[model samples]
Target chain A: MAGVKALVALSFSGAIGLTFLMLGCALEDYGVYWPLFVLLFHAISPLPHFIAKRVTYDSDAASSACRELAYFFTTGIVVSAFGFPVILARVAVIKWGACGLVLAGNAVIFLTIQGFFLVFGRGDDFSWEQW
Target chain B: MAGFLDNFRWPECECIDWSERRNAVASVVAGILFFTGWWIMIDAAVVYPKPEQLNHTFHTCGVFSTLAFFMINAVSNAQVRGDSYETGCLGRTGARVWLFIGFMLMFGSLIASMWILFGAYVTQNTDVYPGLAVFFQNALIFFSTLIYKFGRTEELWT
Candidate 1:
């Protein structure tokens, strides 16, 4: 029941995040959809982590090069996602208001992703690794 | 030259031991810096698309800096120190030479960006954002590579 409730909450947050992303793009005043490219970032952010997990051993060392490289790429992807809208706004390609909306959406969506990882990444019966 | 510089250097201290998270933190910081550099350059490109406004040739600085980034990180500290790497033709000397070339490229690009900023934009009294972007891009990438190279400890964990 607790897991079910958590899933429900996570889904609601994800929906809210998507709603904000859509509003930033589809709103009448903004009408620009370049902010949607952040979705590509969101889709690929977990890829490095997955690849690193598969490549590196679960060692007692503080960190491995593979994991650190993965973290570096993940951070790059995340910052690029935030920077994209700001650059668009700076270049007059998108409105500042739209940029703000997209930034907010990015925050929410990234948080939801993090939450999903935290909740599902446990190495237990209900672990996401099973998938 | 090395002996002269060693005379003025401060003795190394072992007082501060970094936490286990230092590697991850350093990588994240380096990544952020690297991404910011490219993003700033991209903003300039978008804002001023014409060759007259911002010369397309200036982007070579960034391209070289990125190449330097890869070159610098390709050899690990152990490999450079000849601890773990032994089979290569030049061995540790090869790693050191590679690192030296990488550093030279990084510094050369940075200086070139500065020259472009001053010669093309500042002296001409034209718009400076594009020039500033180029300089900042190379500078940030240089620092990012430095951090990624020296900010973490490479230990053989038993």
Candidate 2:
């Protein structure tokens, strides 16, 4: 439960952070900078979570399942955050080819997440046994 | 006070669990926001005077859809109580569908704007009415596929 909460918080915050960063760049007429910042922020945001997951696991405060859940959250945030900048840059520059790539990338992420949830998240409980 | 209670009341909600209630409310809210944002994008794409105006409208729709996605997920998370992976997964699926729909709408708006831009480039004129008509014809076909796919996916709504 704690792990899921952490994941939700992480994902939502990452989305909000990237949205704000894009808004800032849009206001400044910085075409490419927005995507660059998105890439950077996603790369940075996972470090703390990774460390926290490791620490929690080593200390036995959380189970392996919790750690795995944290990892999923971390990865989801990173992928989704990376998406924003790519989409923004393509739209801003009006590069249809690049936009197509962005669209394909988003489709992959969307499908991967959907697949993961469908396969692994179908059980009634997410206790350590499920992991 | 009377109106508030009346608005909150649902004829079939007497035995609904809290989680189900939350999910139902969140779904409706998400759908409403998504549709409203899409409508604005369509209007802006078809009628906006400038490319930048179209961009602004599309961006606004993106922003709103992003917020709606988060809200729906948050409510789903709360409803699942972190125990039922099945419920959580279903909720995520719902969110994904909404995200896809949002993307498609944004894409439609982008295409419309591009059609206008293309017309301007070719003729050095801002008469985009014909271009918009053509764009809409194609857009309807694309949107129909999306709606069809969404309907076929039953995990979330079921």
Candidate 3:
């Protein structure tokens, strides 16, 4: 029941995030789709962790190089996602208001991703590892 | 050799212990620096789209620096020290050579960025923003690579 509730909450938050993203891109005031490129960042942000989890064995060590490298790449992806909208606005490819909306979406989306990982990654019956 | 090197060494700060979070923190810091460097360069590129405004050649420094970052980190510290990675063709010597080449690439890019900054922009009395961007990109990546290499506790696992 708790897992199901978490899933519902996560999905709701994700929907809100995507709504912001779509509004930023599709709104009449900000009629540019460049902010949609951030969707690519959102897609790949958690990939490094997934890869690392598969490649490295569970160990008692403080940290493995594999995990650290994954973390590094994940951080890079997340920062790039945030930087994308700002650069777009700076270059006049998008408006500042659109950038703000996209950034808010980015934060919410990334948090949703984090929440998904936390809620589903714990190796329970609903664990993402099973996928 | 130790005595001579000690002469140049700064007083050690033992306050920072090797906590478990050190690896994650350092890696995240390095990643931020690396991406920030790239994003700054991209900003410069977008702002000054003409090659005459900012030469396309200036980006090579950043590319090489990025290559160096990967090269330097590809070899584990244990591998360089003749430990866990003994099965390679050249073993520890190979790791050391790889590291040396990586360092060379990193420093070479850094110096090249400085040259581009001063020789092309500063000396010519042209706009310095683009050149400064190029320099900062390489510098940030270089520092990021250095921090990634030395900022963590590798021995904690070994």
Best by lDDT: 3
For candidate 1, give the lDDT: 0.89
Scored against the native two-chain complex, candidate 2 gets a DockQ of 0.02
Q: Chain B vs. true chain B: TM-score for each candidate?
A: 0.86, 0.29, 0.87
Maximum-DockQ candidate: 3
Give the distance in Å from residue A22's predicted Cα in candidate 3 to where it truly belongs. Answer: 2.1
Candidate 3 lDDT over B1-158, as tens digits, reads: 55767668787888877587888899999999999999999999999999998999899999999999999999888888887834767888888999999999999999999999999899998889999999999999998998899987786565
lDDT of each: 0.89, 0.43, 0.91
Candidate 3 chain B, run of 10 with poorest lDDT = B1-10
Between the candidate structures 1 and 3, which one is better when assessed by lDDT?
Answer: 3
Write down the RMSD of candidate 2 (Cα, Å). 17.5
lDDT of 2 by residue, A1-131 (tens): 65466456545644554454544444444433434344553355446445644456344222332333344345445444544544454345524344344344344444444444444454535543543
Q: What is the lDDT of residue B18 in candidate 1?
A: 58
Question: TM-score: which is higher, 1 or 3?
Answer: 1
lDDT of 1 by residue, A9-118 (tens): 88899888888889989999989998999999999999998898888776567788998899899999999999999988897778998899899989998898888878
Cα lDDT for residue B56, candidate 1 = 94
Tell me model 2's lDDT, rounded to 2 decimals. 0.43
Candidate 3 Cα lDDT to native: 0.91
Task: Give each prediction's DockQ, rounded to 2 decimals.
Answer: 0.53, 0.02, 0.60
